[model samples]
Target: MIQSIQYSLDVIQDEARQLVQKGVVSRQQPIYVLCNYIPAREWGWVESELEKSDFLLRDRIGDLISHENWEND
Candidate 1:
């Protein structure tokens, strides 16, 4: 049986924000760039979550993030 993965918009948004804060990805990149960090097998779940939320793969990370926040290093 195939395992079902659950993804929430808030989770995806928070994840993208974290990735940007950690320098794993930049805000200028497309949302699809996130797939590189997520396992290939799980991208379908993430993609569907994004789609359900009206997010497009071509949407920039900066656009997808609800807000931009930076921590002092």
Candidate 2:
């Protein structure tokens, strides 16, 4: 039982770390950052870029990955 618990915790921690890293990358290089040099009215391009970026997709995929690992743990 203790072995199982420890293995589960270790898996969960590793999965969580992956999620955190993905989140940090999404936030740090977000499309919004590109709007800093553009005019306010040009934010649409930045918004569009952000919408198509892997940020949301990565987050959702990461969630699934983490969930799978946690559930088995």
Q: How do all models score by TM-score?
A: 0.79, 0.27
Model 1 agreement with the true structure over 12-72: per-residue lDDT tens digits: 7888999999999999999999998877888888999888877899999998886434589
Candidate 2 lDDT, 30-61, residue by residue in tens: 33333344456645543443344423423443
For model 1, state the Cα shift of residue 26 in Å: 0.8
lDDT winner among the candidates? 1
Best by TM-score: 1
lDDT of each: 0.85, 0.39
Q: What local lDDT score does residue 24 receive in model 2, on the 0 to 100 scale?
A: 45
Give the Å shift of residue 6 in candidate 1.
1.4
Worst 10 residues of 2 by lDDT: 1-10
